[model samples]
Target chain A: MLKISGINASYGKIQVLKNVSLEVEEGSIVTILGANGAGKTTTMKSISGLLKPNSGKIEFLGEDVTGLRPDQLLRKGVALVPEGRQILAGMTVLENLEMGAYHRKDHDIASDLNKMMERFPILKEREKQLGGTLSGGQQQMLAIARAIMSKPKLLLLDEPSMGLAPLVVADIFKIIKEINESGTTVLLVEQNARQALKVSHSGYVLETGKIVAEGKSDELLNDSRIIEAYLGRKSS
Target chain B: MLIEQLINGLTLGSIYAIVALGFTLVFGVLGIINMAHGEIFMFGAFIGVMITSTLNAPLWVAFAGAIIITAIMGYMLERFALRPLRHKQGVSHLAPLISTIGVSILLENLSHHLFGAGNHPFRASFAEISFQIGSITVYLVQIVIFVISIVLMITLSFWLGKTKAGKALRATAENLETASLLGVDTKRTITMTVIIASAMGGIAGILVGMAFNSVTPQMGLSMGLKGLAIIILGGMGSVRGAMAGGLILGLAETFIVVYGDSGYRDAIAFLAIIIILLIRPQGLFGQKIST
Candidate 1:
């Protein structure tokens, strides 16, 4: 439902995303795997309207949405859970959730808030607690729940598992699968290649702002280069 | 005698408190200290006086007219003066700060032309009755100023804490980028913030004019400087800090004038700020400086 074609994004004169492009289907979880400084976040920023691309177009669900503001994209049912989980640290968990749906004029928001509280019980217990005071895992959960609170047709998650424990990472991936199964397409950016491939239907391997490889998740998992670059020692 | 001074100090302090909140609200959201905020206050007071003296209007009419006009001025200051500079690449924080200083000078001069830099009587023709409170007598005007300030404070707290529009404002203040991603129209939030904060300054202007029975284009000059001292003494970007700091400075000024000398009243705000910073550098209620 989302297509990015030859988008070039830059910070000043220095370009970060060089002719990068990717597609996210209507009901599939697409993962973009890359190491640090590989332009993964820049691509997401281009799509989500944080950074305007220097050239090319971004079509979301068939409308040309390039150059729109972040809030504008959100109003159109595209939500991004940015890197580092950028929670409003001084705000309460409930406020954070409410902010996730700031543009919605719908009356069902309270009911959706209740549904989120039910899904993430810790959120209910800590509803009034400041977001900065939450544990890393709990913060990640809040970030995801907050993004989904917008009821976006497409959710872009950037490194949700970064700095998380192994068990918590597994749980996050499980939650991603659950979210995808519930009908929201996810475009996930991660360095956790193994778990990402296992959870995704198809994936692209980005290297230094260029897409180096793209195929079925299982095929990319077995690709010798992907294994060497991302999978590391299979024996471990 | 003590009770009389305390109440008088409180009456004056509430005026300072409202002015300080005006400064703090802009600083909190935009992270830019609007030097022109003092002029907004001054302008509002002038408007109040003009309405009373020229229009022969009631107090409420002058009050509403001053707030609405100043609020528009606040919105224009953000939209026209600051937004363009804010978006420019490689623009340092100093750029916006310097521009506001320019706006301050311009507004002061404009007011000088409009009102001729002279004090005007405001509601002085109205008969004011003083009622006895124990050993102290309080003017009806003083009572009005204090009660209005308290009501304003309560309403402001409720709006900031409980309303969705207020939450959007706080969220933008906390994190601009994240707030945008969450569907907050940051441009609108920022504009509205300045409008509300400037209206606060307008409120202070009316009250001070009423208390002193006169208004001048130069009045905001000293009060503006006092606002800076109060925020520094209270804590930067804190509403409660502004209120508490204003009261302390007000009480200090009142006592100094009564017991020490009238000359020391103006210096009280700066002296208190310096002393407070020496003991607790973050002001009375500020968080530790973050990286």
Candidate 2:
């Protein structure tokens, strides 16, 4: 479980996140839906410790982790699959997967790795291939698979559905649902309102660094303002 | 005659390759040029001399000691000088370069003050032993340096490829922010990179010290410049390319000195770099990554 309260984050003098707050229960897929320049990515980054919050609290699994380093958060079983698939392009697919579990000292990594390859057969097929050479869809799958390697308690995904074909997007959303069903708590940030609400247990709508609405996924999906602004409907 | 020159070139090439490898590693990981790297190399030789003279340790122990000590110094420099500048915009890149130069000058002055600016002999007396092959005579020191360099290169390659820490390092090199998100301690990784690079520089210094029996503080600048040229010639941040570039530069220098004049060696090397950059600015094998 995670709780973010009254968090403010900035890039230099320009504040990006202002008084942002949200919560995610254990094993719940919490979706934060917002348009471009709405500080959705900033909120995720602040939680993952890539951007230190100026003022607020980020408690993950009952520990106050507001100012921790990214690695420290990771060691505590928190992981972030960043906005872009920032895979080490020069490294092989297997190497990228190995890098995902960098903090783990567990000896059963080989078995876990096998499990990952089993889940993504394409990765196994191209295990020796450089990450850069992979197709966009494969790279996205690799990014998610790589994140899964860490066996994270809480996974923060920022825009996983970005830059994918419609079919690929559906496949990725299905994977997200499967990942959530398998008991990993996920906080997904997306611009795809329909797809994100369909799978998320709960959802929040953010506008200009402020959470404008929060409710059950179905309720938020049916809300009139959400339909007009984010759901791409004509206003009555 | 060509065979003799080739053998001699290999010996010199091995040393430059090691130094260039160090440069590329540090530059690759942190995006800092480390102008003080050559000074660290000089310090390694000085450390070797001190260990051999005062502790009377074996040659291998002295060599290892030099590397370990200089590496620690590098770690300290990273913590004290580099980390503070990590978040600073625009001028942050120049800070490390300037700070490293400051450290270089500081070390040079200290060594000069303490060692009295004279050429110092390393305690590795085994360097005097030589072997003859056909018409070519090879000093035992040259052979030892060449063998150790090869061993070090193998060890470095293994460390980078086969180890978890090495993978983390490569990740850090590729994308520091992303690596951190994946659980790499960026602070620690950066420090480790500096240590590894400085250790290589130290080893190169010891090889140079042993081969020539002349250790002077001023030697760091020339060695550092040569390393810069080698890295540029190879392509910035390419380890294998550094090795190839170093060999090319070293052999070219050796051939120039042998057939022409020794004074023209540096000029010819720089000219080669200009020609290479003109032909392929990205470097012989360097990947054009935004550092």
Candidate 3:
């Protein structure tokens, strides 16, 4: 489980997140849905320790992890598949995957790698190819597979479906669902309300760094205001 | 005579390659041109000289001492000189460059004050030993330098290709943020890169001292300039580019000195680099600098 309380973050003099708060329970997928500049990505960055918050607290499994470095957060099993799928472009597919477990000293790494290969067969086929040469969809898959390689308990996914084809987006959502079904808690940030709400158990609508609404996915999906703003009018 | 010149060029080229590799490694990982790198080389040579004369150690011991000492110095340079400027507003990039120049000047002056500004002779006992191979006479020191340099290059390549730490290094180079998210201690990786690069510079310095028979406080300047030229000519941040560029520069310099006026060697060599850059600005193996 993860808890963030009244966290305020900024980019220099400009404040992006003002007293934002959210929570994710164990073994569930929770999504933060927002339009552009709603501070969804900033929230993810704060939790992953890429950006230090100005105030408030972030707790992971009952421990204060506020302002820990990204590597420190990673060791505690928090992995973020960042916006734009920041794959190691020059590295080979296999090398990129190997980097996913850079901090692990356990024996399961090799087996986990094999499991990743099995799950993403395209990656296995291009094991020796450079990561930059992969297609966008393939790169997104590689990014997700790389995040999972750390054996993370809490996975933070930011805009994984952005800029992908509809078919590719559907495939990614399916994989996300599968990943969540495998018992890893996921905090997904998405602009794709319909798909995200379908996959996530609980959802929050973020607007300009504030959580405007929080409820069960189905309830939020059918809510009149949310339907008007996010989903549009339902065709009877 | 050409064969003799070629062999000599190979020896010189090997040293350039090692130094250029050091420059490329730091540039690749940190995206900062460490102007202090040449001073690290200079310091290594001084350490080599000190060990050989004061401690009366063997040549190998001098090499080891130079590497270890310079490596520590490199770590300190990153930690103290460069890292503090990393997060500064607006001038983050410029600060490291200017600070490294300051560090270079500081190192050069401190060594000058300590060792005095004169060329110290590195008296290797085997410098006199030579073997005649047809028309080309091969000295023991030349053979040692060539062999060691080649071995180091191969080892560096292997380490980068096969090791876990090397993978982390490449990841850091490719994307620092993503590498950190993947659990790589990027700060440690950056420090490790500096240490390795400085050690390479140290090795090159010692070998150059043995070859030229003297070490000076200002020796790193010209060698460092050549290293910059070589990396640019080959392609910045490309390991293979550094190797090829170094050998090319070495051969060109050797041929220039053999056939043309010796004084025009550095001028002609750098002119060739400029001409090549005009043709392909990315160098032989360089990718366009991505934003």
Candidates sorted by DockQ, best first: 3, 1, 2
Model 1 agreement with the true structure over B1-291: per-residue lDDT tens digits: 888899889999999999999888888888988889899998899898888889898888888999999999998899888888976899998888888889889999998898897778778454387888778887888888899998998888888888899889888888889999999899988999999989999989989989888888788778899999999999888888999998888899999999999998899998888898899888887766221
Q: Residue A95: error of model 1 in Å? A: 1.3
- In model 2, the Cα lDDT at residue B183 comes to 88
Q: Please report, as a residue range, the 10-residue window in candidate 1 chain B with the lowest summed lDDT.
A: B282-291
Compare the candidates by DockQ and give the number of the best one: 3
lDDT of 3 by residue, A82-135 (tens): 999998888889988988888889999999999999999999999998888888
- TM-score-based ranking: 3, 1, 2
lDDT values of the candidates?
0.90, 0.88, 0.91
Candidate 1's C-alpha runs over 4 A off are: B124-127, B288-291
Model 1 DockQ class: medium
Worst 10 residues of 3 chain B by lDDT: B282-291
Question: Each prediction's TM-score against the native?
Answer: 0.97, 0.96, 0.97
lDDT of 2 at B212: 72
lDDT tens readout by residue for model 3, B109-176: 99999999988998787889999988889899999999998999999889888999888888888788
Better of 1 and 3 by DockQ: 3
Q: Write down the lDDT that model 1 would get.
A: 0.90
Compare the candidates by lDDT and give the number of the best one: 3
